[model samples]
Target: MNINIFRRKRKIIVPVLTEEKAKETLVRCQSCGNLIEYEDLRKNLKVCPYCGYHFRMTVSERINLIADSGTFSEIDTEIKAVDMLGFKDLLTYKERIKQTKKETGLDCAVITGKAKIGGFNAAVGVFAFEFIGGSLGSATGEKLTKLIEYAKKHKLPLIIVFSSGGERIHEGIYSLMQVAKIIQAVDSFKESGRLFMPVLTNPSYCGAAAIAMTGSIVIAEKGSLIGVSGPRITREVANKNIPGKLKQAESLLQNGFLDTVVDRHLLKTTIAQFLKHYNRRTI
Candidate 1:
């Protein structure tokens, strides 16, 4: 077959990006796709000032944003992840743990500590979602259980800043059992008349969602997703349409699922107020 094809050449237009406007001038908000200055974002605690999009923050940033300066004393820093079941997929579990630890500068996905929020002593745990999507493993469960016990023993309020996807499947069934261990520990802590607060961030699913639902004083960031399962799994397992509105913090707040929906900038003060009230009640 003989055919004549006429094609026009495509032009690649290179954007005339200036040095000031390259990376320093504007940082794009992931949710709203708005370019905002670094200083402006930092001033608002990494939240989108224009659209009020709550950005995911690092574990250190989370701690600093909530806890008072010079008051965070980390507990159980020695407890790191261990290889069980000799799990390997592309790399061994130990190798993945090592890589994640080296990069994130943390032993596990979760960090437990005693801190003074608003000058009221609290047992705080922050999950690092960057590390294995903040997966809950045996060590994570142990740390959380211990944190709860510590809170009960010391009569300190317990708060967990959660940002997790699900259980660490690398540990197999052991990882799946974490929620059970946590539930038991939480019940004990509650029996001791200790307050437990679970502050949820974006995409709090699986075990993290369980914690969010369990807390007496539950809080989530605005636009945060809170559910037992995310839409994908829920659609498959339940064989039904995923209700988009039901997953957001505002909807949950309206439905009385969440105690409050807080802005990242005001999170510190809101928690501080809660702590202050509890402290006064105890006194």
Candidate 2:
């Protein structure tokens, strides 16, 4: 008996689109109106190629972009805020903390870790702008000190990606203490002959600016606001108009407060070069 050969037909499948899927599929650059793939945006370090507009990056993303591949070892990841005064203004401090946690997925404003930059080991700390405006609270101070200590112990250079609105107002005076604490830590690290590099991102103001200036080498992002107070706040408090762009990174660099003002695209290369020069000198 002859048996007939049968062939199975391949089924064609097509993806169905929902409103949410369509919305999330792609986005245009706000500045250039150029279509950008979601994954491409992330891979490009959150910069729009069409217009050269830099997108805001979270602390983790900053760390990932700066650090060598698979080299970041995080420390003090569980440190969180505490409501010592039981502060309750417009919203309960506890509830505010919960909201920030949910929104940012970070326990505090800063994340401390160790990573390699250009094959040179360094201690890295990045401030989470999404977390309460990257406010300096007790936990932030503690983590910063811990990072410095780690750097000292490992004889590695310390790098901080600082972006903050200064101290956390809800935390009151406790937040102010962080300024002095971090300053002392940086000073000690310097006294030990180790390098402390502070990469100042946009809107670094108040206490954070003060601490950032203490770095052995301070670099600011192009067009970043580097000041104790923003223009709007200064104008409001002084009852007068402040000059536009008073606190821009370029102005700070001109005034010699910043060592360099670097473009977002060249930041990694600049940092790597600095680290290379530093390591060669130390060796």
Candidate 3:
């Protein structure tokens, strides 16, 4: 059988993106389902322009956003976690630590340092959730304790950004011990009469929430999950359908659990204003 087929050639357009180009291109807004350009998102400090949803920021990004340019001096950079238990489940604790270090480039879950915020010196500690969900462990607690002590010694205000999943179960009882260490450190730091401000971001749960709540003034980013346990765990433990809004920053603020809930766009300015006001009163 012989058949005659006439086909029209059409132009095919396929966009090729390099690694850098692909990363810098369009990003989907999780809240509003808008496809936003990456540059626009960065300009807006990674907030969703459509629905005003604040995106989670990296440690470096948060530091740059809050600290003055060339003013961040990181301390306790050499502290790294050790596999004291040598325990293994799916992977060894040592292996897990190594993997997270390779991925996040952090010695521990938290980074402690001194930074100048709005021209005022303060000891700053920021959690990197990329490091094993920013679990509270011995190393993290030590770093935080040192940060508090440094703040007290220098008579500087203390600012810590809390973002953690809870205690690191891998570290066993050692991780749980950190809660006491943190509380004691904060208690002594309070005696100095310097401000201790905690910035609670998304997923501030369990021990992290407890530590942040101890701050002289607690501020949470808008839409942050500020609670002891997350919704799922709370539902399972209580055996009831927990209210979805109960653990949110807005709800916490309304219920007197939070001092302020600031939008991402105004977070730096708001914190600076608080610092300035507090310093003036003390002076």
Candidate 4:
């Protein structure tokens, strides 16, 4: 018997989601351009096996991936966005909210819930980018505030996984104001001796990022963006070109901003370990 024959073969790379292939069973990887089976892609937790590109997930998917089965229940499910300032550009704010709700089955950008990760009870809040770019609006602000309160009252560790395109420009100043409100909530949680974890996902910038920066143990996905503003806007404001990787989570960790940058596959285990370590005293 040859030793080479016992070794497993590596997969060949292939194009993105848009390109067509002869067999419908194959799909291309977005980052590395490798062709992978749809089922295999899903089994890998949507992370590209070739390049380690972490794909975005819906709120439901995030919960199912992290929370123990039959242990997650959403709080504040009825909150909806308001058309403050009667905002209208290409589309009216009211219409945008309605359209996003219908499409995403989410009233706002975040889903606040109570769940047990690794058998440790915790309060979790996950942002859904499918709704209006996951921007912070009045309803989003309210939910964040309430989630903190619920966690503090229950004495459970809180995990807020955020990925936002910034403040809701559609709401004008009202959206920008949420930054301070959420920051205050973070302070309140800390004052009560509760563990607050802010997990940044892809494209996490702007007002939401400001609030998340205050987490007790700040963590982010490996390739996530972590900054106040995006590269284009920062360049325009500073009148200088920024490095392409400056806003990424890996860069932030190197710069002493993030506690750790974990891959999506290990996110649940890492968070659960943190919860167990901190939650023991309280329980």
TM-score of each prediction: 0.87, 0.86, 0.89, 0.87
What is the C-alpha lDDT profile of model 3 across 1-283, one tens digit per residue?
Answer: 2211113232322122223544768977767789888778778887889998777777778899999999999998888888888878667999989988876678899998999898887899999876887899889999999999999999999999988889988899999999999899999989878899999998799999999999999999999887777775576566677786788899999999899999988888988999999999888
Candidate 1 stretches with Cα past 4 Å from truth are 1-26, 232-243
Deviation (Å) of 208 in candidate 2:
0.9
TM-score of 4: 0.87
User: Model 2: runs farther than 4 Å from truth?
Assistant: 1-40
The lDDT values for all models are: 0.82, 0.82, 0.84, 0.82
TM-score of 2: 0.86
Give the local distance difference test score of model 3. Answer: 0.84
Candidate 3 ranges with C-alpha deviation above 4 Å: 1-22, 235-240
For all candidates, what are the clash counts? 0, 0, 0, 4
Ranking by TM-score: 3, 4, 1, 2
Candidate 2 local Cα displacement, residue 10, angstroms:
56
Scanning candidate 2 in windows of ten residues, the lowest lDDT window is 10-19
User: Which of the predicted structures, 3 or 4, would earn the higher TM-score when compared with the native?
Assistant: 3
